[model samples]
Target: MTTTSVGAPKPTRHTADSEGPRRSVRRRSLGDLRVALIFVAPALLGFVLFYLVPTIRGIYLSFTDYSILGNPIWVGVKNYVKIFQDKLFWNAMGVTLEYVLLNIAFQTVIAVGLALLMYHVAKSTLIRGILLMPYLVANVIVALLWFWMLDYQIGIVNQVLQWMGMPRVAFFGNEFWAIPTVAFVNVWRHMGYTALLIFAGLQAIPGHLYEVANLDGASRWQTFWKITMPLLRPVLLLVMVVTITGSFQIFDTVAVTTQGGPINASRVIQYYIYERAFSQQDFGYGSALSVILFVILAVVAFLQMKFLRGNENDLD
Candidate 1:
């Protein structure tokens, strides 16, 4: 209700002008959200249908007796109670632990050493490609290849051992050597990939720190201990979590090479679960075993992250 002279400026609807851009911005935001959802829909759907649904179904099946031939009968905690009294379960657990320890110990140390060598000596793409080739091969193929190569009768390894004046040892046949031989095969297959992971971590470390250490007259060993190890802890934590979990779920190599032979020598927990669920048609017991493994892995991961301070770095 204000009058304006001809020479004076005209009043503009600032509120209306502001609202036009606001509405445009809101429309743009909604359009972007739609695009994002469209992109994410496939993976989200996969997670819900495959992972989430199977996990829930498995948990429920753990409480019921589902033999696939008949309807599931709810047995409450009976499967779990049976698992507690199962000596085979305990033996599988112990054997799996031995495999995990052997695999992790050799794999981590060798991977770190290879990473260091790659970082310092040969940082070539060709070398890295050759190292990664074993990992690219299928697990079954790798296991079978190693199985034949380590065969006691006419295998290359045994031939070399005999040439060296040592008796040909049963790499996969004997109970004492079965688990270790299986562990070694997996270690050889996976170390290259693990080395690349550690190599990436090494690349992240600041080079200037090493230079400063050199200026301070620090020995190579001292620099590695003080600088490299501290900064590398986070990456090591990640490597440990991944490798240890995968090691616990060892089945393919054992299935191919040993088949849990020589009196359950290499029967890992996963193999045991597979036998119960598939061979014996005891889904409830298998599911209960799977749940126990899940709990163990969860606790182990939590402990590793907590103790290693995985989220925190000493780069400061």
Candidate 2:
């Protein structure tokens, strides 16, 4: 419908429809980006200030002899060397490793079991809240509650044991039982919390998958193994990573119940760090240990991520 010079007659023009949509989409994306940045800025700033900055500064301080009140003295790797040579450091590290392993085992198995039980039962808000009640309690309170429950003389647990004709044994007072007792208490407090997280993952699984499995006459065990466990890998890995970090850094329960007692048996890396940095005023060595712990957690988390991503590709 356009007119032009005779030589340029019939020159074609493209419609604006396609280009218009592309431009509109770009504008909308930019708008969304701006909104996202605005919303995340406060949290991002807090994280950088509180966590990232401290982490970087702490790592730098690990190579220096630092006391909070004085300027840091350049110590190179002297602190690290001392930590490596210290027998108590290795003992604490061993205890931390054992705690992490036991916690991961208990938390993973018990959480998964409880999650499965919840998934099968009638879904009720009350039930969910009750399950998570212990997790909501403060760490100190959880420790105190378990401490009383496991007390040798006046504790209900020992009384019940006595009723069953079993001898009453001191849990935290014995070096051999101290670590396991604290680990068990931690599991009891956190099992429901982890289970609820896993339950949410269980809920996300498509119902049609189960229906198809049912139609194929798959046994419950086979369906659970073949379908549920595979689909739940990501969530399980998340729980494992978190629980491992927490176990390695456990402090409140040990402080309240055992105080790393009976022979420093229940002393974890976090408590060790605390005693060194604050109580004994050995900031440099503490920072070195902190760096070591950070490295350990980073390696574990990276491994978990690698495994999770590998499963994703396989699942796809």
Candidate 3:
């Protein structure tokens, strides 16, 4: 052993030198991180200033007694209590739920059908673009346009009905017809975009899968059930979430078209919130209502997620 052998490995000067560069690289990385944070600072600031702060403030306001023009008085859960006891609030809740359920049902069936139809159509882009024109139109404008078209007497639909010897339907004027008409208008405005989303999903299915299905002598319905639906799950989930979220937040259409109707038939929760907040200027109560809305939406979204990915045999 030349008197230099040792049982343990000895540290080398070269190893020490190598560590210097590693330290230098680490310092540079830290510098780069600081620069990256600096670049992101404005967006962080904007989010904190605009969204986070307001959300926190709104949550606090929900427990208070403050009209928009008045100073906030901490009244505990009085606002929530009031809203819970309000019959109109409960009615709005029921109406809103009905709209969401119906909207999602019609959208799911129609949009999926449209997607499947367009998947096979020639010159699809042109057709899809034309369809999307309705979605591109502003909600308020669409509602107003539909309002005119569905009017009791002078509107085109009624005019045509009159000419065809059918009774003029009171689309927005009747309690029973009011909500359905608004919901229909919503679907008409948004169906194209929903179909586009589903179409994209359809396009993503591997062509080889379909070829294999054909080689297996699979019927078209068989192919659809086994291949198409399973593959479209993710996009379907996304569409469900989007539609549900939008349905809960529906206000502009109800406002512009029905104004909560001749009998509050079209008064969704959002419309109810608007009545409390802006119309009556009870900001605190409105905030409480919003908080309830938030909880309802959160629960609904959680359930949707659970339903989408929860099953033990599921293949997400």
User: Best lDDT goes to which candidate?
Assistant: 1
Candidate 3: give the clashing pairs: none
Candidate 3: count of backbone clashes, pairs at least 3 residues apart or interchain? 0
TM, every model: 0.90, 0.86, 0.88
RMSD of each: 10.0, 9.7, 9.5
- lDDT string, candidate 1, 1-316, tens digits: 0121211222123333555666665656556556656676787778779977888889999999989789889999999999999999999999999999999999999999999999999879999889988999999999999999999998999999999999999999999999999999999999999999999999999999999999999999999899988889999989999999999999999999888888889888999999999999999889999999999999999999998898997876
Inter-residue clash pairs, candidate 1: none
Q: Where is the poorest 10-residue window by lDDT in model 3? A: 1-10
Model 2 residue-pair collision total = 0
240-265 in candidate 3: lDDT tens per residue? 98799889999999988778877879
Q: Candidate 1 — what's its lDDT?
A: 0.89
For candidate 2, the 10 contiguous residues with the lowest summed lDDT are 1-10
Put the candidates in TM-score order, highest first.
1, 3, 2
